[model samples]
Target: MTRPAAPSQFDDPWQAQVFALTVALSDAGHFPWTDWAQAFGATLKRHGANRALDGGADYFNAWLETLESLLEQRGLAGQAEARTIRAAWEQAYLSTPHGQPVKLPA
Candidate 1:
């Protein structure tokens, strides 16, 4: 018997972006993949994630949390930098016109 495939598509676009960012950062050697895997696993365990239901298994947020935690722990980037970047994106998203894509401020 074959195991079920993991769901690749996320319910939200930001979740997808967060998932991609983790892979890109790992590929670029910002952090070792093993470390990332550990971080992600630790986060899932902390959150008591139930991997069966779609809503229950919203792991993208966990992925983002893991990445942020590693950045803080490893000093690749700190919490302040993460906060600033996240805030900028939030502002850009709020400022964007309806039905238009968000763009970062110049």
Candidate 2:
């Protein structure tokens, strides 16, 4: 199966780093989309539109940093280990087959 095109910022190296971090945290059970969306919305509220746009990358980076800390605190993964796992997960998700359900390891 084909993967969708990576989002615009995702094409950038630094942006891809943050994106990978976020995806990794999600996979590691740090926080689900509902929790993330709420946090993101709260961030937007505190920052307002202009700053949100201008500093969005920094915001995402901060979010990722926080996620890593949370994961470590919960004993889910250490920071370096999480980075390795995240990289593997990013490659697998973006390259694997589609249109058929695949069993994921727990």
Candidate 3:
């Protein structure tokens, strides 16, 4: 039987969240949209050189990478902090029961 679809436009919740965050940051003038576009395009090109991009996780992963890099360069967040946050999210995701909203541990 086919699985039920998620109530989201993107394939994964994280994808949607990241997309929104990027747009919000751009809207807030944290970075120029043109810069974001150029950086994202470069990231896509580098990732695509390794293998095919299915416009799913691969696309979002590249998007996330570009955002992280931009934030790092702007001194908003460093790589170590990003890795720590990522690890926390991963742990939260893994610990949450299936079909329930994941929340970071207090």
Candidate 4:
């Protein structure tokens, strides 16, 4: 019998996008990769306390959280702004018609 293919590194496009963004930020000298690894590890530990991380949404959520916290610590972006943007995206996603692109307000 043929073996099944290995799963993709990310379950969703957003996860991949976040991963790329993190790498880009680190490469740009915003912070060192070691710092990113440390923060991401801590976030995983904290979030993993409640549930199993399947390297899917749960993992990426923790990753996104770590990135956001790091950015805030470095004075790059505020948590409030992140929340606002998330809310806006959520609203846009909910209001948009199925099979259409979701657009955020200017």
Top lDDT hit: 3
Model 1 per-residue lDDT tens digits across residues 4-80: 48864576777878778878988998888998888788888877655442333456767777888888988988999
Report how far off residue 9 is in candidate 3 (Å).
3.3
Pairs that clash in candidate 4? none
Error of 4 at 73 (Å): 1.1
lDDT of each: 0.78, 0.65, 0.91, 0.89
Worst 10 residues of 1 by lDDT: 49-58
Residue 69, candidate 1: alpha-carbon lDDT: 83
Query: Which tens-of-lDDT digit does each residue in 1-106 have in candidate 3?
Result: 3444764368889898999999999999999999999999999999999787877788999999999999999998898998998899999999999999999888
**Ranking according to TM-score, highest score first:** 4, 3, 1, 2
What's the TM-score of every candidate structure? 0.69, 0.42, 0.75, 0.78
lDDT of 4 by residue, 1-106 (tens): 3443995677789998999999999999999999998999999999889877776688899998899899999999999999999899999999999999889977
Lowest summed lDDT window (length 10), candidate 4 = 1-10
Strongest candidate by TM-score? 4
Candidate 1 stretches with Cα past 4 Å from truth are 1-8, 49-57, 99-101
Provide backbone clash counts, one per model: 0, 0, 0, 0
The candidate, 3 or 4, that scores higher on TM-score is 4
